[model samples]
Target: MRLFLTFCAFFALVAVVFAWEKEDHEIFDLVSSIQASEGKDVNFYSWLEVSPSATTAEIAKAPFVQAYRKKSMQLHPDKNPHDKKIHERFARLGVVSTILRNKESRERYDFFYRNGVPVWRGTGYYYSRFRPGLGTAIVFLIIVTSGFQYAAQHVNSRRDLARIEDIVRQARQVAWGPRMVPVEGQRKVKVNLGGGPESEAPERWISMVVDANNVYFLHPDGDMELLDASTATQPAISSTWFIALVRSSYQSAFGRSNDLKEAEGVSPPQADDDELSGTASEAPGSGTVTPREGQTTSTSTGKRKKATKRR
Candidate 1:
């Protein structure tokens, strides 16, 4: 009997080993990919030779501009004819300086710099930031809004449709991400286990809502219909499922956004606003005021008084 019980226990361990859910595979695979990915973006601060905390007000000082000009002069293509790569470095220097010098551009870059830019966003992975541009909005409006108009185009239906889209958007925002499952009980969620360029994109996520008695899968053709969840795979899940959905939606919309930006005549890369036109204006305490080459400012009381009088 003791030997029989040992054999039974051994078999139970084997069964548990094989019982790892499909989601466990996907989650581990995705996280491992993020871990191994070579998607680290460049840090503009390091390129500019400035402290991370350096303020724009402080950066516009003569001392900083003097350093930039010195580097620019050395790296100027006319001067570095032998170094073919010097132009690229020189161009980068100008860009970094402009980004850091401008208050708006600097703030935008700093937000990503300090908070950490999302590596998995809008790439191969199912994660991206929500930045719906004018073009995307127009296409979506035409598809959904016009579809509503065609099918019983009632004003009330239009209002309800808009409301439903808003709710789904809000719910989707919180779905996919990292979370601390408490020490006690686990919160159960349902996630579809298939997705990629070749597979059914929406099938990759059948439905995220576990509580909705009648769940619906959103189709690629922009139709939402009631479906029997009895046959669909369901698993207790986490935010990672929702993140996959968000990434899928935003990435598709983003592709459309490129077309829209082009139509709207907005260039993706514009000259930065903080470009120094004339010599930088001297702000208060603009670093140590050094006399020009070959000129000396008198330190004696008599010469100082004389200079003040001249001013």
Candidate 2:
């Protein structure tokens, strides 16, 4: 009876020791499981103990396959239920094997291994910067071409504004008897430096205009006085010169720029016209007259009020 009790005590003590070890394993959890895997930087190649550039077929050989199966089972969550990281590692190992075993995926992994990852997408968001295909290239070209066209139109519009402003400056000097004024309440004028579709009116086409005996420029933002014409003078602009300017603008818009030199003889020179009349004359039927460009032909011999009447 005493030997039997001693034997039972020994058996019970062994059971207690085994339970304690199982409890320790449960407490440590994934730590013990992590130790099962080798290497601090166990990439797929190192994990499988294969060449860095091993192909899918090579990796699928009997030896590699056996190693993969054994490792997978050892690190599986079921094998270490109390540990979580080993289960994760086991899952990760499967993914690594898949990537390294496929031709495309393997090439991608190789690239990442060789070169440093991009900082923008460094959080494991592996991606490729693919080249634009034929369709994409065509779309890009279309956008660029449209942008250039709009830019050209914009530039031409600005240039036309400047020239019209010069004419207005000259008009102001002639309208007010070549004198300068700085009064407020300056009104707006409308001038149409016409260059559009063929469907627009001719004489009614507005480019630049005058108000309050002052010459102001007209653009998208309405009338503005960029230069003071009260004292500053400009050469007289003839009907021919104005026509060439408009024609050049129109043709340039249509991708055909007319040479400005061709307009030289087409219009009477400002110097010659001045010598003949010594006063502003309307551009043909413009009806405004003064001592400068595009003035109304109004011979009204009065003070500042009558000046704006010059065509």
Top lDDT hit? 2
Mind sharing the TM-score for model 1? 0.27
**Candidate 2, residues 1-311: lDDT per residue as tens digits?**
99999999989766654442332232123222333555545455777667886667988898788888887888888888888567578866777677667787676657645773333332112112345788987777866765665566556656666765666665554444456563345444343344456746553333333556555555667645454433333223222334456777877875432455555538774566546564435567785444544343433475343234244
Candidate 1: clashing residue pairs, number? 6
User: How much is 73 displaced in model 2, in angstroms?
Assistant: 4.3
Among the numbered candidates, top TM-score falls to 2
Question: What does candidate 1's lDDT look like per residue over 1-311, in tens digits?
Answer: 99999999989867655543443333334333333431233356554457779888889998778878987797799998998667766776676688779887677667656775444332222322245688987776766754554454344455555645543443333343344222222212335444567776644444434123333445556455543423333322222334455778888999799988888896467544344322234665675443433444566464632222223
Instruction: Look at candidate 1 and give me any clashing residue pairs.
Output: 176-239, 176-242, 176-243, 177-239, 189-237, 194-204
lDDT of each: 0.54, 0.56
Model 1 weakest lDDT span, ten residues long: 180-189
